[model samples]
Target: MILTADVLENAFVRLEPFEPSMRAEVRSALDCDPDSWGGMVAAAYGPHFDGWWTAAMAAMCAGSRIPWAVRRQSDGAVIGTTSLYEIRPEHRRCEVGSTFYRPETRGGPVNPACKRLLLDHAFAAGAVRVEIITDTLNPASQAAIRKLGARDEGVLARHKITWTGRIRDTAQFAILDLDWPKVRQLLDDRIAGFSES
Candidate 1:
């Protein structure tokens, strides 16, 4: 396995290694964009997002070889990030999370392109089932995962305690290797449609 922080690249994005220097980019991405995500979801406040920052830096320093800061291949703007956390080669499973994007890149090609890149890599790495979880209250994220054709794998009740000291239920989603063909095909169609100008 290619373990030890590395960049994920493709035609659309050049995800860099997340570092302390990029803290501003990460903080800005989380802090000012959503403004409560149209009040449809509780916007991820900046202070609470430190967890993501810590994890990313740790991953870069000693964790694994896969965490990356997502950037436009064209401009290299630090727009967002994602990582393959809790990787278990024995189980061939890993959790893909800690994703955030700048407002400008949202509802655009960044997400699908990023996911397309990550999922493609994950499967190639022998990950039979890749899982992602989001807060149940975060309908927008849930909808996005569903749109990716991930199967609803039930909710993990009181899955975690938020920074606000409230218990949060997490909605889980997964796509297995067997499902990749269809999922990939679906994503291909969506991305193609996204690029049809």
Candidate 2:
């Protein structure tokens, strides 16, 4: 279960290891829609952006998380960020989370394309199970996760304390290795549909 931060990409998006040089681009992409971070436990917009960026960079530097700057393939623009964290090789499990995308990239091929690449990489690295968790208040996120073929595993009460000191409940979803083949096909078909359109 060796999960390394290698470049993972597809036709629509490329997941490159997050670097300090990408700070401005990433910040600009996130600033495009401050409202988008409403449901996020950590602040990634406006006044909180600097702190969030600092902590994120620190985490990446410590090897506590494998973070990627999600780049749009067409123009190679940094549009978002995502990570593979809470990695446990002993359990052969990890989480694909801390994901965010510019509002413009939502509701299209970007998500599926990104997920397909991430999931493929995780499983290839010997992940027996991968979890995608979201704030319970974020129905849109929950819906999107469900659309990825992840099974709802209920909510964790008072799961985390947000940056604003509010207790947040988290909805848990998971896709097991046994479910990978189906999930993979579903993602591929969805991405293909976008191209077909």
The numbered model that scores best in lDDT is: 2
Off by over 4 Å in 1: 1-4, 34-52, 60-65
Q: Give the runs in model 2 whose Cα sits over 4 Å from its true position.
A: none
Model 2: lDDT to the true structure:
0.89
lDDT (tens digit, per residue) of candidate 2 on 75-115: 99889889888888899998998888888889988889989
Evaluate candidate 1 by giving its C-alpha RMSD to the native, one decimal: 3.3
Q: lDDT by residue for model 1 over 113-145, one digit each (tens)?
A: 888878888888778988988888888889999
TM-score of 2: 0.95
Pick the TM-score winner.
Answer: 2
TM for every model, in the order presented, reads 0.83, 0.95
